[model samples]
Target: AITQAEISVQELATHSGQIEASNKALDDIAKQINMFALNATIEASRTGNNGQGFSVIANEISKMSRSSHEMLGKVTSSLFRVKEKIDATTAVFATSHAEASRGVELGSGLTDIFEDLLEKANAANDSLGSINESIQSQFSSLANIQNSSEELATVAEKNAASANMVASVTEETAAAVEYVTRSAMELTRISESLSQSIPTAKMFDEWQPDDSNEKASQ
Candidate 1:
C-alpha cells in the first residue's frame, strides 16, 4: 500500500522550509542577545560599584555569548552544508517517482553504534532546544556578529583581524589563525561528511535540521 510521490515531495518541501525558518529565528535570537550587551554596558556605567555584581554576571554571560557566537559562527561558516543536503534531498525527491524508496538495512554488528547516534541526535536536539530557550544571557555579545561578513572585505581579512586579536591575547599571527581556521573547516567538513555517509543514516534518509534527529534512523 503506497501513496503519491507528490505527497512526499510536498512534505519534504515543508520540512525544508521549517528548518530554514528555525535557523533564521535562531539568528534573530542571537541578534537580540547581542543587543543585551549594550544595555548591560550602559547599566554597568550607571550603577558603578552596585553594577559590579551585575558586571561580573554580565562578564560571565559575555563569555557564554562568545562561545555561542563561535558556535553559530562555525555553523554559518558551513551554511553550504545544509544547502548541499537540500540539494541531495531534492534529487532524491525527484527520483522518488522513478525508483522505489529504499530504507537502509541494518544487520548484526553495526546496529548498536547506529542506535547510539540516533539516540544522541534526538537527546541533543530535545535538550538543546530547551536549554537554548532558558538562556537569556548568552546571545548578548553576538549581536554584532550578524553582519560581520557584510563589513568584512574578505574571510582572509576577517582572519587577519582575528589574528591580530589572537596575537594581542596569545601571540599568534593572523596568517597562523587563518591557517588554523581553514584547516579546521576542512577537517570538520570531512568528518561531517563521513558521519553522514554511515549506512544506518543513509537509510530512512531524512534531511534533519541537526544531528539531533538521528532517531529518524528508526
Candidate 2:
C-alpha cells in the first residue's frame, strides 16, 4: 500500500507538470489574442464608417481574451495549491510506512523471545521429571532434590505464564498491524480516485512489533 501510494504521488507530480505547461501555453495564447484585438480595434477606428462592425468584433474578442486569461490564472493557482497538499500528504505517508515497518520488526523479535522462553520452560519441566525419578531411587537425597525440584517447577510455571502474556501481546500487535494495513489500502484507493478526477477539468485523457507486523500486516 505504501508503494502504491508513492507511485500515485509520482503520477500526480507528472500530471502537475502537464497542467503547468498547459497553463503557460494558455497564458501565451491569451496575450496574443489580446494584442490582435487591440490592433484590430485601432485599424477599425481608422476605417471610419465601414469599421463599426469590425470594432464590435474586436471589443468582443478583447473581452473574451481577458476572461480566458483570468480563468486560466485561477486554475493555475488552484493546481499549485493542490500540488503542495499532495506533496505534504506523501511525506506523511512515508513516515507512517517507516513506523509500521519498525513495528513489524519489533513484533518478530518478541515472537522469537517467546519461542526461546517456551523452550526453556520445557527444559526445566523435563529436568524436574528426572529429579523426581532420582528422588524415588535415592531416599537419602530426597530432601535436597525435593527443594531443587520445587524451585525448578516454580521457575517453569512463571516462565509459562510469561510466555502466555507474550503470546497475548503478540496477537494484539498483529491486529493493530492489520488495522494499519487496511487503513493504508483505503487511503491508496482515495488517492487513486482523486488523481483520476484531477484530469477531468483538462479533459485530456505504521507504528508498532516484528513477528505480528511481518506476518499479519502484509
Query: What tens digits encode model 1's per-residue C-alpha lDDT throughout 1-218?
Result: 32332344344444445445545644754454444444444433544553455445445545545576566554443333443444454454444323322333323323443344444433423433333332322233233322221222122233442333222322212232333344334434433443333223444344322222334555
Model 1 RMSD in Å is 16.0
Error of 2 at 34 (Å): 1.8
* Candidate 2 residue spans exceeding 4 A from truth: 1-3, 99-194, 197-218
Give candidate 2's total backbone clashes.
14
The global C-alpha lDDT for each of the candidates, from Candidate 1 onward, is 0.39, 0.41
Best by lDDT: 2
Question: In model 1, which regions exceed 4 Å deviation?
Answer: 1-10, 74-80, 95-218
Candidate 2 worst ten-residue window by lDDT: 199-208
Q: How far out, in Å, is residue 180 in model 2? A: 45
